[model samples]
Target: MATTDDSFNGLTEYCEDCDLETLHEVSVQIRTESTKEENAQFSREPYRVCECQRCGNRSSQRMNNA
Candidate 1:
């Protein structure tokens, strides 16, 4: 069998313990910014909770809409 690293591009993250960036899975998505105000300029930022594929450790990254 053969494997490829192409699929792991965006899905991978830096593993501190592993001393390298490895594949990760998105565990949960949390909205860091509130759009409930319903203002003229409402922005929403999201926090992506990711889990390390090898260690099962969790980490979060805030992503903004571009």
Candidate 2:
């Protein structure tokens, strides 16, 4: 299950500003979508928000839970 809280550290990704791969602070957040029913049902999709340690650049991408 994906958690509601954010997590940080131990993540590395490419930074455009730095022009290299660097460490990052990563957090996970749930993206919810509602169904067309009267009482809507929500589905959870998780994504990661990453901030580069070197240049402080930030980016986001969808996380595959499979």
lDDT of 1 by residue, 1-66 (tens): 112367753477677877777777775464536546775245555676777788888877777657
Candidate whose lDDT is highest: 2
lDDT to native, each model: 0.65, 0.68
Question: How does model 1 fare in lDDT?
Answer: 0.65
CA deviation > 4 Å runs, candidate 2? 1-9, 33-43, 64-66
Could you tell me which residue pairs clash in candidate 2?
none
Candidate 1 is scored at a TM of 0.48
- In candidate 1, residue 63 scores what lDDT? 73
Clash list (residue pairs), candidate 1: none
| Model 2 root-mean-square deviation | 7.2
